[model samples]
Target: MSESAASYKQLKEEFVSGLSGGPVGEIVAVTAVLPIAALVWCLLQKRHAFFKPYTALGNVVDYLLNVGAALLAITLYANSAVLLMVLLLVPALFVLGVPPSTGARRKKPKLPPAAKSYNSNDSKDDTGSSSSSRDFDVLSTKPFLTFFRGSMMVLTCLSILAVDFRIFPRRFAKVETWGTSLMDVGVGAFVYSAGLVAARPVLKERAAHAGGRRAMAATLPRRLAQACRHSLPLLVLGVVRLLSVKGLDYAEHVTEYGVHWNFFFTLALLPPFVAIFQSALKIIPSYAALALILGVTYQVVLESTDLKAYILTAPRVDLFSRNREGICSFVGYLAIFLAGQDTGMYVLPRKINPRSGSSNATQRTTLLMTMAIWCSIWSALYFLTTDYKYGAGLSVSRRLANLPYILAVAALGSLQLFTYCLIETLCFPEFYSAADPKAEKEAYNVATSRVLRAYNRNGLAIFLLANVLTGLVNMTVPTLDASPLASMAILVAYSAVLTGVAVTLDAFDMNIKLS
Candidate 1:
């Protein structure tokens, strides 16, 4: 690298270095806005039928709720985080802390009157026969999970480049080595999401084959090939990104993942690993337990030995040393992935009948179990992150993807899921009462939250587009020196483009799945 380029890289590195981050409560507040805003937006759309009167207004609302609010995850959030937290506290205390409200306002297909997803039964020893299994269903359309995942992706898209500009809050950027930031959602939540979507299929496979070694042997080659096919796209993207950054002398941060390592490569490596051990439940039984074992064992390695030191300080003479951070952090991400997969299984049915009280009972049983586990996770988080010894206060490292980081991801991800479920249950009653779940799901998707569906459909494609746009803007415009007004204008326009494309693609049923 040239001297001036080297100096510029140094300046960029220093700017993002050593940040301890703001209160975790504030980060949670930023997270709170996503589900709250999405639920509110869905409600408003259901009630107003805004698109019927004015399509443009509906589009704007989608932008604000999906992409615009996601931008807040990285910027403008630290300012009024307390207010958001206060708003979140009221509902959280009522929803998770106390008995779930039994009163659900019933509405028709237009609004699907209520969710009542978390209500406890009058039967003290109720068998798990309840509609609460599909907790965030919003019933057929899945607005909650779709919107939730889209927001995370958009926020990541915005923050990856937003950190380069002066207008973006430095505190929200990825932390130097440890602590938390809004951007710290990073690959943990993301890979967790990937796992969430993959969970049902894995379960189906396990059930069909009965975890037989012979069955796995028959499917293993095809699974590995399919995984490789998916991985190829990501590998190509990683190589292209690396070559472009080096060839163009782009402004880059080497320490972020270390020399020659980028997020794409980190992603590229995961699929094959997943394919190899996708049947792990046969041996470990519970994905949650499996994830905990790997994460705690990795944490032990980091704390008891010199691996962490080697990752942080080793010379980049060989490929392994050059990308130590990404290599080591992969274990953490995989654990988070399995944990997410466990959650995916939560909302699905173990039997064929959607309305069979017996099946519903099993699903509800799973939901309650999930909640129990969720509480234990939070308790573990509190103890592990406490400041006494290797607590999160001192040991949490986004770079390392340490034990504390996995716990935080699991806690926060579950919190978001539960919040959405609570909203769907309270607001949409037709879902559980509907005779045909397949038809109702389609109706809800079309009538209420098509934008979110579109986003969910073309997630990877949109992320790639955002990456391209960010690079173009950085190359053509002086991000670090732009006026605040100009920067805001640019960011809004960027978000608008992303949301617009997603909407348009959904309108046409165009879906792209690139790693």
Candidate 2:
């Protein structure tokens, strides 16, 4: 047979193969075990040391990471190989802090001579204030670290993996070829990434060890302004999305099925609103309460209305569902995203330190217990919901924020993460060194450098390039092809090619944007 015929036959064979649910489950199980094992081993090795103080830090990071990860999940909904890879890759940024080198170049940790003299003079009465301010400054540097390490690592792994397989859900039987979920993920990623940057100053203020709260407070408005401004690129993307609905004939293309045209429009409206909310949070101290109220209200709407049906299946409209039905109606979800962002801005701290404790072992044990309970609850819910068929019929009363669902999802995630930690610990007890975390980094630097170099040099450019690449890929292929194996293969190929191109361009410091 000719080469073309052979290629077609191979594609046919690939399409015929099904994803073995067992393997998928095992992968999930292993990923969960890695982190859990890591946590345990760390505790065991450091059992002689004190650990309580670090617990808060871990908790804070975990919370932020989860929110960030959830933002990543929006990509999964789109079921795009490109989108999923991006989603999985970007969160690594939040997990790992900025590279050590970036921090070194930014500034010298020095006090102004006048301030030093004033500090010396005031030390007798207000040393505490000065110390507090210093701590805040230290914390502000974390975002850069996280952005560099986590984002690079995650993206590298995801890009490589995309060449191996596509990861997605088995449900959504007749869902579009690609996931409309990318819209959410794209919006969420920008929001979450930018939010982390904005959070740095606020958290720094809280962590400050030397500057008095007054000094920090005085600088906050300016800091907030800078953060908002830095986030403008993402916000602009959102605006483009919103306006696309009006000017772009998004529907003319067959590839547009999974494209939720208005998701970004909704996202475009979040930052400014969040900025306003954050300002209020300074005065009210009720951001959490407000978030709770709004979340609950949104849930109530989901539960009581035919909103979901209308949003998921209906034809297009100007403002509402783009024209489908579901509680995820653009207008409604936008409201939720705005509310969530505000809550996160005002209530979520930038860095969380663990509580000081006398024993590391004890804290580890506590975390493990928490994981066990969370897992139990999640397992229970998964089984219970196995029988609940999701219908297009709108049950206006089933809020997506229903207590059970929220609790279950969180628990499942925690359990999964803990399990992964545990497995990693079992596999390699040492922090990254045991498995040479930098192995990939070095390899990425060498072979993959051409495409990734620019991204490595500057994150913003890489992000734009990545999105454009993803969009182009999405336009080129069927986004929602449901056969798991076939989808996975296609995505893997797509990811591989993109990564190769990205790496090649990065190595050369060629800044290119696919968009």
Candidate 3:
């Protein structure tokens, strides 16, 4: 056979071989099993009574169910089963259920004049509080959903990096992989979702200060200063990693972040950039629009120039060419972060009313409906953008962080939040009221909350630990050559160690907060 025919034959073999079980199968199998286990546990807990959605047991079941559904959807997509992935929508909606509302609203009794006067005075005092006091308030407010998200982010990062996961075909050509791949979505989602949480406080504090020209000017410098301070450690680490054996082979570098350009550098710089823009424009940039513009510009630039060629085959790895994706993708990631900030604006508030028994139910239902709508819209847009001629169809590209990829990450993150919200509202409604010390204490005592809080408290540390462990594993073990079972065993062991460390640190109040 001719060389061209041989090449084609090899490509066909690769495509066929790539369809086998890997991390995607493992995750899907686990997702399918966990819900069933949770259901069984719930049933055992409610031996004589019907399962109560508002009870702790019910909350556990709900959490498991939602997680399983989301995982199943993601895994299916990763495996190139787009139809099965789409079919998950119906069940996700059914599980999400309808929002329940009480037709009657409770009337608040009027306070005595003296009491009213005291409340007014308290409000004035709060308004006049120092910035430190406000910061403390922000620190104290640890929503369950936020904790859940942080934990999930850590878990997803581990799953992608620490194991032999099936990578979907890069494009929609003759290769047989479906929708957006998990590897592509993981890091972007992690960064963007975390950014959303981080931005809330900055925006809130700015609004509180009645952000004007002077405030904006002051804020920019402070944000820049903070960015520099945060970037220092990441820079040091990046340099160290690059100088070390890990950087010897360019192909081994998962993200060009530390080795070529630092993602932390991008992340650190983005806040100040956003702050400056917001200050100048006197409006927050629409994240969706920004993402669209950035993604399109990136595609245009790639198609219009030899930039792609330079990126792939530069004479030597340099700051610019080696880190082209790292640098260009910053805008896309920034847009994602901003979009996350918008999401945080909607999700961070505590909407459930403890006085209403059905409030939790209502909140869960609303989240489900909202996530479903957004997911569908994004999915449709993703398919619509497919350039069949070029064999590119919204495949998740961490390097590009394109529109479809952003939407998919946002949708997945939203679904994860919905699951956490269901658990928090149904199982521990009072947990939402951070202002109530008694409720907060009670909520913290719960087993689930304790584990989540542990992860939340030391999220950064846990992430760093995973990175270190991954490096160690790579150096010590033949990861690529290991059997699937062996790889998974290592992953499980790594995660367990990380979790144990996190929980122990939490117990000792030893959180490693880089920022």
Candidate 3: the clashing residue pairs are 80-178, 257-261
- Residue by residue across 405-435, what tens digits does model 3's lDDT show? 5665666655555555444544344444333
Error of 2 at 377 (Å): 8.9
Q: TM-score for all predictions?
A: 0.82, 0.47, 0.66
Q: lDDT per residue, candidate 2, 368-416, as tens digits?
A: 5654654575446444433246423221111222323332233333344
Q: Flag the better candidate by TM-score, 1 or 3.
A: 1
Model 3: lDDT to the true structure: 0.49
Best by TM-score: 1
Best by lDDT: 1
Task: Give the clash total for candidate 1.
Answer: 15
Instruction: Give the range of the ten consecutive residues with the poorest summed lDDT in model 3.
Output: 108-117
lDDT of residue 330 for candidate 3: 76
Q: Which ten residues in a row have the lowest lDDT in candidate 2?
A: 108-117
Give residue 222's error in model 3 in angstroms: 3.1
